[model samples]
Target: MILGIITDCTHYTSPSGEVCTENHILLRQFKHLSAYFEKTIILCPFGKFDDRKVTTTYTSSNIQFHQLPLVGGNAMKDKVQLLVTVPKWLRAFKMLHRQCDVVYQRFPNNLNIPGFIYFWLQRKKVFATYTGTWSGYQGEAASYRLQRWILRSPFRGPVWVYDEKGKEQGRIRNGFSPSYSVAEWEEETAQVEKRKQRIENGLTTYKFLTVGTIIDYKNQLAIVQACHVLKQKGFSFQLTIVGDGPMKAELEEYVIKNGLQEEVKLVGKQNHVSLRQLYREHDFVVQAPLKEGFGKVPIEGFFHGVIPVINNISMASQMIGANERGFLFDASKPNHLVETLLSLPAQQHLFAGMINKGRTYAKLQTLEAWAREYYETVSAYYNEA
Candidate 1:
């Protein structure tokens, strides 16, 4: 069967007119998922390419790219463009719906809204992957909430969501996204042993790392503040902030202003290889975002044998295994994160079990496993038809 995917995942059209992406996670995921279907049609936003250092390429032979204009924000221009492009979006999904046998819509996305409607009206075999906070948050866009309600309440379409493990009834299923492949996961056992020894021996210098676009919603500034607190407390630790964004300048200035230059290193974005190495070297992955769907960093950290330290979000407790696998803090109070880290010495005894459980979870939710399971779930659901 041919699979159709509509997502906000950005694909880049290079200066040479070739389509590729720096989103290695999605690149690997789509490629692997394509193996299950005869063909795949990916309808996504294609933007002007930034000449980034790292890229995970895609071939047009098997997976076709259906480009859509970018739609975001609440500005007047954004609203006008969103309105004007309605026809393009509708026409695109209408065309795709006829050719594809199954539709995989990545939801809580503006672009996928039209596609979701087109597929749903036709009663096409379809499922959505909503990778955002499912249980509502303090400040969420109306469009986001509307899409969530549509998928969860009105429509009974099967969806792979996050953080709704047991509370999810009917077709609403919990899911996770993976960054590493099975071959790379070969050393998981050995890595766990090394992590156990390091934890049991007690860590003198803690290394904390967070990787993502330096955006406000990401709350990376909170991380820098936590580092400042740790430094003042005379804690010997290093904080590494990876990935670049509009707020990079502000974060840099904050680090310089607070005299956290030595303590906090905002190294921008690194290539895939460098990122993997950084994950392996770090003792913990600190995710302080105000809200998140799955907050994939912890899962990626789990794969590399790095524990998670996250702020309380929808999935925080569940993903952290109720603080058994990792630690959860209050984002409102940055010092809560400081307190969590400071307790490491006394809490060291819980490390081995946590590390083992984390790695085991990561291994089970690999890219292949995610794709395969999604395929199986959607297939089994369609079988009931």
Candidate 2:
């Protein structure tokens, strides 16, 4: 059967005849989906093809790319452009719907709205996976709210959300999982064992790692402040901030001004492979995001037996199994994270058990396992008719 995927993700072609993406995870998902379906059509906005900037490696013979006009943007001019261009894309989506046996759409995307409406109008079999926080949190874009409303409508088919709480709202489980292979897991496990030995012998300094784009929404500044509190309280720990964004410069300035240049380091962005190596050396993965959608970094950290210390938000708390699998802090309380960090060394011995439980949980949610779940869900719905 032909599987059509409607998304807002950009697709680019390299000058050397290679299909590439800036998002390695998305590229991996596409490759996995291609393996599951006989013919997979990726419908997305086509960006400028440049070999020089291409970073992600992904190419599949069974996968076909269908570029459409760029649909959503934040500016007023972009909205006007979308108004003038949507009709043309609507016709393209209708044609795509006619060729597909079933349609799968990524939610919280304005570009997917026209395609979703077209599928509904034609009574096509379609399912969606929501990629944002399912807690109905405020500050979400209007387009995202509209998309959620449409998916929750009775007329819509099965909708998958990343949080367990979403099940109460009629959303299915779309759990976040890591993409680590068995070999990688074994290697990371060895590193974790070595680190545990060092912790036991008092030969290691506590290492904290946070992986995500540096943005206001991610609340990296909160992590810095929390670390400052820990330092003032006489805690010897190092924080490594991964991923880069607009907030990097400001965060760097704060670090330098507070005499935390040595304690805090902004390492910019690293690929998945590099990140796995970095994860091996860290004791805990700390994140204080104001909002989160599944928070995959924690899951990824778990695979390496690194404990996650995250804010007590809905999706994050649920993913970490409400502190059963990892530690949770209240971002609202300034001293909460600091207290948690300061208390870690005294409780370091208990980390072995926590890491074991977390690793076991992460092992079950690999990319292959998730793909099987996704394929089964889509296949069941397709066979219903």
Candidate 3:
């Protein structure tokens, strides 16, 4: 059987005919699906750019890419361009629906709206994965709310969601799962053990990390401010901010102007391997994002036994489990994070236990297992067809 995937993430084709993407997690998920299906076709926005500098690439002869003329942007001109290209996108989806046996659309993406509607109209075997906040629909964009409404309709097939609260959508079969791999869990365990030993030897400075794009919603500035508060309190800690985006300059200015250069470091984006190393050395993963879908950073941090000290949001509390596996602070108040960090040294004895429990939970959610579940869910629909 052939599988077709629709997503907003960009896919790049190297001169050597290799599929490359900046999203390593998506690439890995595609690779896992490739093993189960006879062939897989990824339908995403494509651009003709040199991918030689890109570190992550997926090279599989069985996997083919069907690039769509879907130039995505939020600007007014880009919106007009998208409207003009709607007819072309619909035609492409109709063709894709006929060619593939199963179609999987990643939700919360406007690019897939046309494809999803066409596939539903054709009565095709379609499944979806919603990797967004599933708690309350309030404050979300109208398009996002519309997508959620479509997924919840009785017409949609089995849907897998990252948040357990998504099960409330009783009209559709919603499954909850974490995105991780066995190799990742094993590496995290090793790192956690090494860090545990170092902590036992009495390390001086506590290392805290936050991984995500430097966006306003991500609230990297709040993290920096909290670090500043900690520094004022004479706490010996270092906060390393990873990932890059438009707000990099603004964040740098905040760090420099606040005289927090030594307390906070913006390491920019790093490859998967480099990130794994950082997770190993860091003592805690601190994030106060305004919103999150699945909170993959916390999961990745949990695997490495890096206790997640995150904001008290739906995704964070759900992933970390009521502060048992990790700590949670109020995102609305920056001082809450500072207070959480200050209490860490006093609770140092509880670190090993939390790490062990987190690793145990992460072990159960492997990519292999997720693929198996996905295959079963899709095969049921195929059988019905």
**What is candidate 3's local distance difference test score?**
0.79
Residue 217 accuracy (lDDT) in model 2: 88
Residues 1-385 of candidate 2: C-alpha lDDT, one tens digit per residue: 8888888887777777676676777777767766888998888887787534426756588888787775566799988988998877787787778888878888778777777878888888877788887666887788788877787784366677766464544445555644665566666777777766767676347899999889998999999988888788788899999988899999999999999988999988887678878898788999998887778888888888889999988677666775667899999996898888888878877788788888888888777777777788777765674
Clashes per candidate, residues 3 or more apart or on different chains = 2, 0, 0
Order of quality (TM-score): 3, 1, 2
Query: Model 3: residues >4 Å from true position, as ranges?
Result: 48-55, 74-76, 164-179, 381-385
- Which of candidates 1 and 2 is the stronger one according to TM-score? 1
Off by over 4 Å in 2: 49-54, 164-171, 181-183
In model 2, which residue pairs have backbone atoms overlapping below 3 Å?
A: none
Q: After superposition, how far is residue 88 of candidate 1 from its true place, in Å?
A: 1.7
Estimate the overall C-alpha local distance difference test score of candidate 2: 0.79
As for candidate 3, its clashing pairs are none
**What C-alpha RMSD separates each model from the true structure?**
2.1, 2.2, 2.1
Q: Whose lDDT is greatest here?
A: 1
Compared with the true structure, model 2 gives a TM-score of 0.92
